[model samples]
Every structure is written in structure tokens, then in C-alpha cells.
Target: MKIAFYGSSLVSAYWNGAATYYRGLLRSLAEKGYEITFYEPDVYDRQKYRDMEPPDWCKVVVYEGTIDALKAAARQAAEADIVVKASGVGFQDDRLLEEVLGNASPRALKIFWDVDAPATLAELKSDPDHPLRQALFKIDLVLTYGGGDPVVNAYRSVGAAECVPIYNALDPQTHHPVPEDSRFAADLGFLGNRLPDREARVEHFFLDPASRLPGRRFLLGGSGWQDKPMSSNVNYIGHVPTRDHNAFNVTPMAVLNISRASMAENGFSPATRVFEAAGAGACLITDHWEGIELFLKPDEEILVARDGQDVAALIAGLSRQSAARIGARARMRVLADHTYAHRAREVDEIFRARLGARMEAAK
Candidate 1:
């Protein structure tokens, strides 16, 4: 099958948290013998800032021009067996949504894949006419990163014709254990963009614990974090590229997973870091969130913290051997049930089912 997907930068993780997610899903799809053409806007010098080059699995097309003038690309997208418009395309997502929907082939399975399901559903509650909100029922399927009843019900209430949760999963080939790099070595490590929804959680779960252990070296990576004041024990390695994720994960004695407020509250919304940290064989300590046990067995495969005090206690008591055991178990869990190959198969089944239904309706 041929697919056309338009999303955030596939080459750069800079300011684009969805880059890893896109890569994992697309790579898996291509491995399944599907032809894919990925479209990304040439904004923010993403091509120049890219840390990884596009793989041979599919074609990468970068477009530069107004949304209206980009209709020619939409025409090409219409020819694919499936066309996807992922959430947060960096800019002009509303216009792109309208154009892509308008140009979709009558027989193609056109989908709106919402990577940030919580934020989208929450906003739709307040503004029903939120561009994409109006197009939900018209789209053949709505794929999401968040799972569980809360996320599913929210999408249904918003008039989504059908919704499926394709949660984040590990790409073992890209994220497996690697030799630690001294530049990233630390007692604690965290990589994430500094957004309003997550900054407070980072303070509560990561920074506060770092402060409690004044002698322990803590390393923070990712952009938009330099503006914040940090503790003396904390080290800031600004904007570690995607290529260094394995080294970054392994270099830390243990890595932290702090979920954004919306994702945490909704449950079953594991961020890309959770799997990446474990896939690299790094012990993980995450904040308390509902439905976490479904993914990782806390106190066994992983550790959970309620607050800064809990995090400090866990850090103080965890032994090297225990940490290594936990990391190993977590990695084993993801390798068996939570890889891109697993999720890609699920997506393929959903696409076939949706396409069949569309065919029936046409007949």
C-alpha cells in the first residue's frame, strides 16, 4: 500500500517532540512493504538543524510556500492509499487540514492522527469549531497517542467517526543500550522541551529531587529550558540531538520520566521518553499516573514517585544492582509487547477495517 503522511519534521527533533514518534511509526510501516511519502514544512531551518538524515525506507519531501500554494502537494497526497494529517504540524495546521480533507481521494483512508490527544480534546471541549474539530466526523479515522477510556470517550463525544489509540512504542534498533558518553554522564538525566504544561512537573519530579541531593550531578537536555533558573547541582547540556538519545539515556545513573499535566491526568499516555529511557536500559522513575501499571510494573520493572520527597527517597535507597535489574526488566517488557512493529501491525489492521467499511458504504 502507498501512504502519504504530513507531520512535523522527520529529520529534526529540535523543538519537535513528535519526530521520534513519527520515525518509529513510519519506519515500521515501510518495513511492512508499504510505500510512504512524508511531507514536512521547511520552517525554523529544520533541514539544517536536523540531527539524523531520512532513511531509505521512504521519500521525504520538504515544502516551502503559502498553504494555498501547497495545494499541488495535496493533489499528490490524494493518490496514496492512505493520507494522514498529524497534530501540531508546526504552523498553519488549520489551513492544511482543510486542504488535505478537500483533496482526499474518495477511496483513500484519510485520517487525522492526533499525537497530542489530551490538549486537542481539552481545547475542543471549550471551542467546538476548532477547525479540525469540525472535520472529525468527515475523516475516516482518528488515531491517537493517548489510550484508555478517558481518551476514547472524549474523541467519541467530539463526533469522531472512529478513533483508535496507537500509543508510543519503542524502536529497539534506534534506542537500545549504548556505551555511556562522559559529556552526558550524570546521577540523574531528563530530556524534554520546556512547555507550560510540564515545567511545574519537572520541578516537582526532577529539579526538586536534584536540589535535595545537592552533591549528585544532574543533567538536563532539550531546548527552551535554559531560560529557567536551576540549582547548583544541576547541569544543562542544551539541545542534545536525537542521534545522542541512546548515549544520553545510558550516561545517567537513572533517568526521570515527567509527563505533562494533561497526559498524566488522562492516563495511559506514556511519553516518548518513557520507552526511550527503558529501551536504553536506564532505570526509570516516573510521577504517579493512573494506568501506568498497564505499561510498566512499578516497584518491579519500574519505579513511581508521588512527589519530590518520594523521588529523593527512591534515589537514596536504590542500589546499582537493583537499578540495573529494574532497567533490564523494563527493557524486556517493551521488547516483547511495546515496539513500533507491534503498534504498526495494530494500525494496519485498523486501516484495513476502515477501508472495508468505506467500500461497503460506497457499494
Candidate 2:
């Protein structure tokens, strides 16, 4: 099966969270005998911050961010078995959706893969001028990275013929335990970019904990956090490479996972970091979310923090042996049930089911 993706910069991981997800998913799919092509609008700066070079597993085409380039992408999509347009393409080229729907072959299944389901739904609900609303019905299927049953039903209500959640998964090879590095080694570490909607949660969950534990070392990584005033005990490592993630995860006594506004609002949405941290055998302390137990068994495989005080207490109280035990359990669970290979198989099943339904309808 030939599958093509139209989405944000897959070739760039600098300030690009979705790129890590895409690379892992597509790479796993490629390993499963699916021919894959990724179409990304060449945002020139990406060349400088490229993390993983285009692997031999798939063909990657970078086009100029223009109507002409989108037209070219549509032409390329015409030959694929499946063409997926993902959210957060980072450019204002809504016309690409039109060209893909208009140009793809009959056998080609067009999918709108929403990485940010809650944000997309909220925007569509509030903004009548949203360009993607009209295009939703035209796509053959809608797939989301997160958001549970409610999100799928809502997408169907908005005219998606089918909606599926292909939640985030770990890439075991890329994110496994590593020896600690002094630079990243911390009592607690939080790695996420700053967003206004998430600022309050970060303060309540992360910052407050750091302040409470004045003697313990805390670390903050990711972009847009340079200017944020952190306590003196908090170390700020701006934008660690995806390759360095495993070491970063393993170095910490416990890693922190904080959801954005959309993810927090839409429960069951575990970010890629959660799985990545688990894969690295890192004890993870995440802010409370419903359905977290469905992924990682709370209090057994992972720790949950309801607020900053909870975070501080967990860090201060847990012995190293206890932290290691939880981390090991979490890593085992994810490796068995939540790896990229598992996700690729799930996607393959979804594709087969869609095709089978189409065949049955025709007959």
C-alpha cells in the first residue's frame, strides 16, 4: 500500500512536536511494507534545525510554501492509496485541501488527521470563518492522535464519514533508558513549550513544586521558556534534541508530563512525551487527567499530580527504589502495548476496515 502524508514539517523537529510523532509513525508503517511519501511545505529554516535526515524508509518531498507547490502535491497524491492532510501544517494554505480532494484518484482515501483535536473542535465551534469546516465532509476519514470517544462522535456530527483515534505511541528504539548525564540529571524535569492556556497549569503543577523544594534540582527544557522566571534551583536547558531525549529522560529522578489546554480539556490525550518517557524507563509524574489509567496504570506504573503540592510531595517522599520500580513497570507496559509498531498495525486495520466498507457499499 502506498500512503502519502501532507502535514507539518516532518523533516524538522526544532520547535516541532508533531514531527517526532510523524517520524515514528511513518517509519513504523514503512517497516510494515507500506510505501510512504511525506509532502511538507519547505519552510527554509527547517534545513538548519533538521534532526533526522530523510531515511531510506520513505520518500520525502519538500515543496515551496505556495499554491503551485500544493498543486504539485495534489498531483502526487493522485497515485497514492491513501493521502492524509494533517493539522498544524504551519502555513495558511487552506487551498491545498481543495486540490487534494479534487485531484486524488478514486482509490485514494483522503484523511484529515487532527493532531490537535480539542483545539480544532473549539476553533470550529466558535469560528464560522474556519476554512477546514467545509473540507471535513469531503475527506473519506478523520483520524485523531488523541481525544477519546466524544471527540470521534463530535467529528462525525460535523460530517466526517468516519472518525478514529490513533493515539500517540512510543518509538522503542529511539527512546530507551540511557546512563545519566550530569547536565540533564535533576530531581525533577519538565519539558514542554510555553502556551498562555497552559501557563496556569504549569505554575500550579511545575513551578510551585520547584519553589516548594528549594534544595532539590529541577530542570525546564523546550522553546519559549527562556524568559520565564524560574526559581534559582531550576535549570533551563533550551530545546534538547530528539536524539538526546532518552538521556534526558533517564537522567531525571522523575520526569514531568504536563498537557496543554486542549489536551487537558480533552481527556485521554497522552502526549508523545508520556510514551517516550515511559520507553526510557523514566518515572513519570503527570498532572491528573481522566483515562490516564487506560494508558499507564496510575499509582502503579506512573505517578499522578493533582497540583503543585502533590508534585512536591511525590518527589520528596518517593525513594529511588520506588521510583525505579514504577518506571520499569511503565516502560514494560508501553513496550508491550503502546509502541509505534502497535500503532502501525492499528492504522493498517483501520485502512482495511475502511476499504472493506467501501467495497461492501459498492456491491
Candidate 3:
């Protein structure tokens, strides 16, 4: 099967958090004999900060930041067996959405893959005529990286023919344990791009803890926090590239996963960092949210923190041996049940079933 995926930068994780998810899922899909052409616009300085060169597993089309270029890409993409217009393309997403749905082949399976389903759902709910809401009935399927039953039900309520949550998973080859780097050594480290929805949570869960525990080093790695005030003990390493993620994960004594406001509220929305941290054998301390046990067992494979105080307490009590034990268990759990290869099989089955049903209806 040929899949044309329209998304943010697949080659850059600079300001795009979905890059790893796309890379993991599409790489696994390619291994399953699917030919994928990922179309990403050269906007948001992502092209300048690209962490990866185009890989052989799939074709990557870095189109210019112009409506004409995007339209041309859409026309080319429509010829594929499956056409995906993912959320948050960082350009004229409204136009791209319309182009994909309007120009895609009649026989092609059109999909809206929402990486941030909660925010998208909120937009749809707030506006009766949101572009996605208006187009939902026409889309063959809606796929989300997170948000379990709530997202599925919401999509169905909005006239989606079908909805599925694939969830985030680890690519062991890309994210597994690595030799710890000295520079990233910290008591608790967090890596996430600074966004408005998540900044307060980061402050509450990550920064507050750093402030309270003045002696403990809290490492923050991501873009857009260079100017953000932080405690003297807190280390702000701006824009850690994709290649350094493994070191950043392994070197930390414990890694923190703080959800965005919408994702935490919606529940069942684990950011890619959760799995990435776990895969690297980093003891993960995550803010409380629903449905975490469905992925990682709390207090065993992962530690759940309710607030900054809880995070501080967890870090204070965590010994190197304990952190290693928890991290090892987390890695083992993901390796057994949450690898991208497993996710790829699930996606393949869903795609095949949908195609089978369509063929039957046509016959």
C-alpha cells in the first residue's frame, strides 16, 4: 500500500513534537511493505533545524512554503492508496485539509490523523462549522495518537465513519538504552517544546519541584524556554536535537512526563516522551492522568506525581538503584507490549479491514 502522509516536519523535531511519532509509525509501516511518502512543508524553521537526512525506508518531500507547492503536493498525494492529512501542519492547514479531501482519488482511503485529538475536538465543539467537523463524515477514518474512548466517542458523535486510537509506542532500535552522557546527568530531566497549553503544567510539575529542591538539578531540554525564568538549580538546554534524545534520557536519574492542559484533562493522551523515556530505561515520573496503567504500571514501571511537591518527594526518595530498577522494568514492559512493530501490525490490520469492507460494498 502507498500512504501519502501530510504532516509537520518528519525530518525535524525542532518545534514539532509529532516528528518522532511519524517516524516510528511510518518506519514500521514501511517495514510492513507499505510505501510511504511523507510530505512536510518547509516552514517554522524546521527545515533549517532538521535533525535527520531523508532515510531510505520512505520518501520525504520537503515542499516549499507556498499554496501552489502544497496544492501540487496534494494532487500528487491523492494518487496514493491512502491519503492522510494530519493535524498541525504549521502552514495553511485549512487549505491542505480541503485539498486532500477534495482532490484525493475516489478509491483512495482519506484519513484525518489527529496527533492532538483533544485540542482538535475542543475546536470542533466550540465551532459548529469547524472545517474538520464539516469534513468528518466524508473521511473514511479518524486516527489519533492518544485519547482512548473519549476521543473515539467524540469523533463518532461528530459523524466520523470510524475512529481509532493507535497510541504512542517505542521504536526500540531508535530509543532503547544507551551510554549515559555526563552533560545530561541530572536528578530529574524533562524534554518538551514550550507551548502555551503546557507551560503552566511544566511550571507546576517540573519547575516548582526544582525550586523547592534547590540542591537537586532539574534539566529542561526543548525549544522556546531560553528566556523563561527558572530556578538557579534548573538547567535550560535549548532545543535538544533528535539525535541527542537517547543520551538525554539515559543520563537522567529520573525523567518527568508532564501533559498539556487539554491532554491531561481529556486523559489517555500520553505524549511521545513517555514512551521514549521508558524505552531508554529512564525512570519516568509522570503527572497524574487517567488510563496510565493501560500503558505503564504506576509506582512499578512508572511513578505518578500529582503536583510539584509530589515530584519533589519522588525525586528526593529515588535512589540510583531504585531508578535503574524502575527504568529496567519499564523498558521490559514496553519491549514486550508497546513497541512500534506491535503498533504497525495493529495499523495494518485496521487498514486492511477498512479496504476489505469498502471492496465488499462496491462489489
Candidate 4:
């Protein structure tokens, strides 16, 4: 299968969460014998911000110039077996959508793989000015990184021909327990970029817990969090490179998972961090969400916290033996059911279904 992935910064993970997701999925697809080409625009100083060099597993093509350049690039979409347009291309270019849908070959499968389903859906629902709302109907299939049944159903109701939830999963090879390092070792650690909508949730779930546990050290990693007023117990370490993520997770007593506001509101949207933490054999404390138990069994493979008090209580009560047990179980669960290989398989199945349907319609 020849697959062309159109997403934001597939070559650069620097401070972009979507970059890691794209790399994992594309690498997995390549392992499955798919010839993959990742098409990302050279925007946001992405050339300077690259974290991982293009893997030997697949090809990375960076598109330069204006919207017209991207439109010209869309001509390549004619040769692909599948063309995926992921959310957050980093620029507001409505023409990209029109070009992808209009220019794609009849044989090529067009997909809108939404990494940020909640935010996209919410914006489209409330705002008349949202650009991609009308474009959704043109795609053959819609896939989401997270957001369970509800999100899938909602997308379909809104004109998606079909919707599938390919939730975030672990890449065990990249994420596993490492020997404790003094730099990352802490009682609790939270890693995520700062966004306005997620700030309150961060304060409620992560920062508040650190404030309550003054004696225990808490570490913060991720971009755009420097100016925030953190408690004395919390130490901000700026951005941790994707390469060092496993080390960061493993060294912590317990890693914290905080969903963005849209994700929390939409439910079932676990960030890439959740899988990363689990894959690293790190005991995780996450804010409660409806479909969380589907991925990680609460109190068995994971711990759930509703608010600051819940988080503080969970941390204070977690014993070393208990934490180790939960961490092990979480890792086991991820390795068994939640890996990028598994996700790629799901995507392949969906593509087959869409292709079959198109053929049937033609006949």
C-alpha cells in the first residue's frame, strides 16, 4: 500500500505533540509493508525544531511555498492508495482542503484523521466561521486518535461517511522503564504544553496536587509553561525532548496525565502521554474521564483523580509496592493490546472497508 500522510510537522516534534503521534503511526504502517510518504509544510521554523531525523522506515517530504505550492503537491495525492489529512497543519489554509478533496485521484482513499476531535467538533458546532466544518463531508472516512464511541457517533452524525476511534497506543520499543536519573527523578511529574483552555484543568489536576504535597517534589516539563506561577514544590524544566520522554517518565514516582479542556469535556480522549507513561512502566494518576477505564482499569492498571483533593490523596496513599504493581500491570496491558502495530492494523481494516464501499458504489 502506498500511503501519503498530510499532517503538521511530521518531521519536527520539538514542541509539537502531534509530531510524536504522526511518527509512531507512520513508522508502524511502514513496518506493515506500506510505502509511506509524510507531507508537511515547512512552517513554524520546523526545519530548526526537528527532534527525530527521518526514520529509515519511511520517507519524509517537506513542502515549501504558499497555498499554491501545497495545491501543486496535492497532484501527488493521485498516486497514493490512501491520503490522510490530519488536524492542525499549523497554518490556516482552507485551500489545502479544497485541493486535497478536489485533486485526489478517484482510486485514492481520502481520510480526515483528527488528532484533536474534541476541539474540532466543538469549534465547528459553536462557530459559524470554522473553516473545516463543510470540508468534513468530502472525506471518505474519519479517524480519531482518541474519543471513544460517542465521538465516533457524533462525527458520523455530522456527515462523516464512517468514523473510527484509533486511540493512542504505546510504542514499547521507544518507551520502557529506565534506571532513575537524578535530573528527572521526582515524586510527581507532569509534562504537557500550556494552552488556555487546558490551564484550569492543569491547575485543578496537577498544580493543586503539588501544592498540597509540599514535602514531595513535583516536576513540570513541556513548552509554554514557563510564565505560570507554580508552587514551591513544583519545578519547571521547560521542554523535554521526545527522545528523553521515557527517562522522564520512568524516573518519576508517579506521572500525571491531564487532558486538554476540549478532551476532558468530550471524554475518552487520552493524550499520547497516557500511553507513553504506561509504556514506560510508570504508575499514572490521571483526571477522571468517562472512557478511561476502557484503556486502563482504574485502581488496577491506572489511578483516577477527579480533583485536586483526589490527586493529593492518591499520591499520599500510594505505596512503593503498590505503585510498582500498578505500573507493571499498565505496561503489560499496553504491550498486549495498545501498540502502534495494533493501531496500524485497525487503520488498514478501515481503509479496506472504505475502498470496498467505493468499489461497490461504482458497480
Candidate 5:
């Protein structure tokens, strides 16, 4: 099957949190003999700060987000079996969705892949006349990164034909145990782009913990965090590339996962960092969120902190042996059940079932 996917940026994780997810899922799909063409808008200085080179596995088209470019993408997408437009697409997202969904062929399966399900659902629910509300009805399927049943039900409630939770997963080849890098060494670490939605949680779970344990070291990684006021114990490593993720994970004594407010409130939304840390055999401590047990067994595969006090206690008291044991267990669980290959196969299964049902109806 041929699939055309439109997203923020496939080549740069500069500000795009879903870059790793796209690369992993698309690469796995390519390996499975499905032809894939990725369309990414060149915006937000993503092209200026390119991270990964073009992939040989699939065709990646970097287009200027303009009316002409939108026309070109629609033309290219028309020939594919499936056309996907992801949420949080940097520029002109609503226009792109309208054009793609309007022009999609009857044979093409159009999907609205919402990586930020919580935020999207919130917007749609809060505003009855949101543009996405109309766009949602035009799409064939709605897929999410997290939010599980709650997200699926929310989408359905908002006029979606079918909704599925395709939660983020690990790509062991890209993220696995690596020798520690001295530059990233710390007692606790947090890696995420600085977004308003998550900064408060970061302050509560990571910065507040750092403030509490001034003697202990803390590390922060990712873009958009420059010039921020942090505690003396906290060090910022701007924009750690995906290639160095394993090293970054191994260097930190225990990796921290702070969820965006929308994701936390919505529940079941695990950040990409969670799986990345687990895959690299790094002990994970996350802010408390509902449905976490569905992914990781708290106190076994991972640790959960309700506040700064809990974070400080966890960071200060966690032993090396216990960290290693928990990390290893988490890695094993993710590798067995949550991987790009697993997600890719799930997409295939969904398509197969839909096709079979269509054939049966025709007969």
C-alpha cells in the first residue's frame, strides 16, 4: 500500500516533538514493503536547523507551505492509497486539511492523525464551531498518540467516524542502551521542548525538585529553553539531537517525564521521552497521570511523582541497583509490546479489517 503523510517536519525535531515518532513508524512501514511518501512543511526554522539527513527508505518531500505547495501535495496524495494529515502541523494546517480532505479520492483512506489528542479534543469541545469540527467529518479515521479510550471516545463524540489510539512506542535500533556521555551526566534529567503547556509541570516536577535538592545535580535538554532562569544545580543542554538520545539517557541517573497540562488532565498520554528513556535502559520518573498503569507498572517499570516533594524524595533515595533494575524491566516491556514495528502492524490490521468489511458489504 502507498501512504502519503503530511506532518510538521520529518527531517528536523527542532520544534517538532513528533519527528521521532514519524521516522520510526514510517521506517517500519517501509521495511514492511509499504511505499511511503512524507510531506513536511518547511517552517519554524526547521529547515535552518536540519537534524537528520534524508532517509533512503522512503520519499520525503520538503515543501514550502503555500497555496502552490498545497496543490502539489494534494496531487501527490491523490495517487496514494492513504492520505494522513497530522495535528499540530506548523503552518496553514486547517487550509491543508480542507484541501486534502476535499480532494481525496473515494478509494483513498483519509486519516486525521492527532499526535496531540488532548489539546485537539479540548479545542473542539470548547468551541462548537471550530474548523477542525468540519474537517473531522471528512476524514475516514482518527488516530491518536495517547489518551487511549478517553481520547477515542472524545473523538467519536465530536463526529469522528472511527477513532483509534496509536500510542507512541520505541524503536530499539534508534534508542537503546549506550555508554554514558560525560556531558549529560546528572542525578536527574528532563528532555523536552519548552512549551507553555508543559513549563509549569516542568517547574513543579523538575525545577522545583532541583531547587529542593540543591546539592544534587539536574540536567535539561531540548530547544526553546535558552535564557531560562534555573537553579544552580540545573544545567541546560540545548537541543540534544535524536542520535545522542541513548547517551543522554544513560548519562542521567534517572530520566524525568513531565507531561503537558492538557495531556496530564486528559490522561493516558505518555510523552515520547518516556519510551525513549525506557528503551535506553534509563530509570523513568514521571508526573502522576491517569492510565499510566496501562503503559508502565509504577514502582516496577517506572516511578511516579505527584509533586516536587515526591520528585525530590525519589531522586534522592533511588539507588543505582534499583534504577538499573527498573530500567531493564521497562525496556523489556516496551521492546516486547510497544515498538514501531508493533504500531505499523496495527495500522495494517486496521486497514485489512476495513477492507474486508467493505468487500463483504459489496458481496
Candidate 6:
């Protein structure tokens, strides 16, 4: 099968959180005999901060950030067996969505892949005239980053023919246990780009916990927050590149995962960092969410915290021995069940079923 995936960026993770997810899933899909072409617009300085060269698994088309260029890209993708427009492409997403669905071959399966389903659902609910809401009926399927039943139900309510949640999973080859570096050594570490909806939650789950545990060293790495006030015990390392993520995860005694407000409220939305940290055998302490057990067992493979107080207590009581044990268990659990290869198989099944049904109908 040929897949045309329009997304944020494949070569850069600079400001794009979905980069790893795309790489993992698509690489696995390519291994399954799918010819994939990823189309990313040359915007948001992503081309300037490219972390990776185009890989052999898929062809990358870095189009100019203009309407005419985008339309040409869309037309180029029209003949694929599956056409996917992912959310937050950092350009004229509305036009791209319309172009992909409008120009796609009648036999092609059109998909809207929402990386942030909770946030997208909130937009649709508040604004009846949202472009996605208006176009739902035309979409063959809605694939979510992960929101479990709530996200699926919400999309169905808005008229999606089918909705499925593809949760984040580890790409073991890309993320695995590595030797710890002193630079990232800390009691707890967190890496997430600052955004409006998640800043307050970061303060609650990360910043405040650092203040409460002043004796313990804390590390923070992300794009923004250079000016953000923090306790004297906190070490701020702005924008740790993708290459250093393994060291950042392994060196820290425990790594924290803070969900954006909408994701926490919606539940079942685990940030990519959660799996990355776990893949590196880093003990992960995450905020309370409904589906923690579905991925990792809390209080065993993972630790759950309700607020800053819980975070402080979890860190306070955690010993090096226990942290290592939890991390090892977490890594084992993900290796057994939540690798990208596992996710790719699920998606391949869906594609096969749909394509087979279409073939039967044609006969």
C-alpha cells in the first residue's frame, strides 16, 4: 500500500512533539511493505533545525510554505492508497485538509489523524463551524493519538464513520537504556515544550514539586521556560535535543510525565515522553490518569501522582534500588507489549480490512 502522510515534521523535533510518533509508526509500516511518503511543509524553522536526514524507509517531500505549493503537494498525494492529514501541521491545515480529501482518489481512504484529540474535540464542541466538524462526514476514519473511549465517542457524535485510538509506544531501537551522564544526573527530570494549556499543569506537577523538595536536585528541559521562576534547587536546561533524550532519561533517578490539562481531564492520553522515559529504563512518575494501567501498572511499573504533594512524596520515598527496579519492570513491560512494531501491526490490520472490503465490493 502507498501512504501519503502530511504532518508537522519528520526530520526535526525542534518544536514538533509528534516527530517520534510519526517516525516509529511509519517506519514500522514501511517494514510491513507499505510505501510511505511523508509530506511536511517547510515552516516553523523546522528545516533549519533538522535533527535527521531523510531516511531510506520513506521519501520526504519538504514543500514550500505557500498555498500553491501545498496544493501541488496534495495533488501529488492524491493517488495513494491511503491519504492522511495529521493535526498541527503548522501551516494552512484547513486548506490542506480540504485539498487532501477533495483531491483524493475515490478509492483512496481519507483519514484525519489527530495527535491531540482532546484539544481538537474541545475546539469542535465550542465552535460548531469548526472546519473539521464540517468535514467529518466525508472522512473515512478518524485516528487519534490517544483518548480512549471519550475521544472515540466524541468523534462519533460529530459524525465520524469510524474512530480509533493509536496510543504512543516505544521504538526500542531508537530509545533504550544508555549509560547515564553526570550533566543530566538529578533526582527527577522532565522534558516538555511549554505551551499555554500545559504550563499551569507543569507548575502544579513539576515546578511546585521542586520547591517542596528543595534538598533534592531537579532538572527541567524544554524549548520555553528560560525566564520562568523556579526554586534554587532546580536546574533549567532549555531545549535538550532529541539525541540527548536517552542520557536525560537514564541519568535522572526518576523522570516525570505531566499531561496537558485537557489530556489529564480527558484521560487515557499519555505523552510520548512517558514511553520514551520507560524505554530508557527511567523510573516514571506521571500525573493521575484513567488509563495508566492499560499501558503501565501504577505503583509497580509506574508511579501515579495526583498533585505536587503526591509528586513530592513519591520522590522523597523513592530509593535508588526501588527506582531501578520500577524502571526495569517498566522497560520489560513495554518491550513485551507496547513497542511500535505492535502498534504498526494494529494499523496494518485496519488498512488490510478496509482495502479487502473495497476489493470485494468492486467484484
- Better model by TM-score, 5 or 6? 6
lDDT of 6 by residue, 1-363 (tens): 899999999999989999999999999999999999999999989999999999999999999999999999999767799999999999999999999888888899889999999989988989999999999988889999999999999999888899999999999989999998999989999999999998999999999999998899999999889999999999999999899999999998999999988999999998888999999999999999898999999899999999999999999999999999999999999999999999999999999998889889999
Tens-digit lDDT track of model 2 for 115-216: 989888888878766678888767888999988897998787766788889989999878898888998989999888787778888888988899999999
Record all residue pairs in model 3 with backbone atoms less than 3 Å apart, i.e. clashing: none
Model 4 lDDT tens row, 141-202:
88898888888888876777778888888887788888878899788889988888889999
**Cα lDDT of model 1 by residue, 1-363, tens digit:** 889998888888888888889999889999888999988888877877998877899798878756744676677777888999999887688888888888888788989999999998988999978988888877988889866778888898989887888989899988999888999978778888899999999999888998899878899998888878889988998888888999998877788889999998888899888999889898998988998988899998889998989988888887778888999999999999899999999988887787888789989
Tell me the tens digit of each residue's lDDT in model 5 across 74-186: 67877888889999888888888887777777777889999999889889999998888977767888989888888989899999999998889998888999898999989
RMSD (Å) per prediction: 1.3, 1.5, 0.9, 1.7, 1.3, 0.8
- In terms of lDDT, which candidate is stronger, 3 or 4? 3
TM-score for all models, in order of appearance: 0.97, 0.96, 0.98, 0.95, 0.97, 0.99
Q: Give Cα distance to truth, residue 255, candidate 2, Å.
A: 0.5
For candidate 4, the TM-score is 0.95
| lDDT tens digits by residue: candidate 3, 1-363 | 899999998898888999899999999999999999999999989999888899899899999999999999988866798999999999999899999888888888999999999999988989989988999877999999989999999989888988999999998888988899998989999999899999999999999899999989999998889989999999888889888999999898999999999999999998898999999999999999999999999999999998999999999999999999999999999999998899999999999998888889999
Please report how far candidate 5 places residue 6 from its true position, in Å: 0.7
Candidate 1 TM-score to native: 0.97
Query: Which residues of candidate 5, in runs, are more than 4 Å off?
Result: 359-363
Off by over 4 Å in 4: 127-130, 360-363
State model 6's lDDT: 0.94
Cα misplacement distance, residue 318 of candidate 5 (Å): 1.2
Candidates sorted on lDDT, descending? 6, 3, 5, 1, 2, 4
Steric collisions counted per model? 0, 0, 0, 0, 0, 0
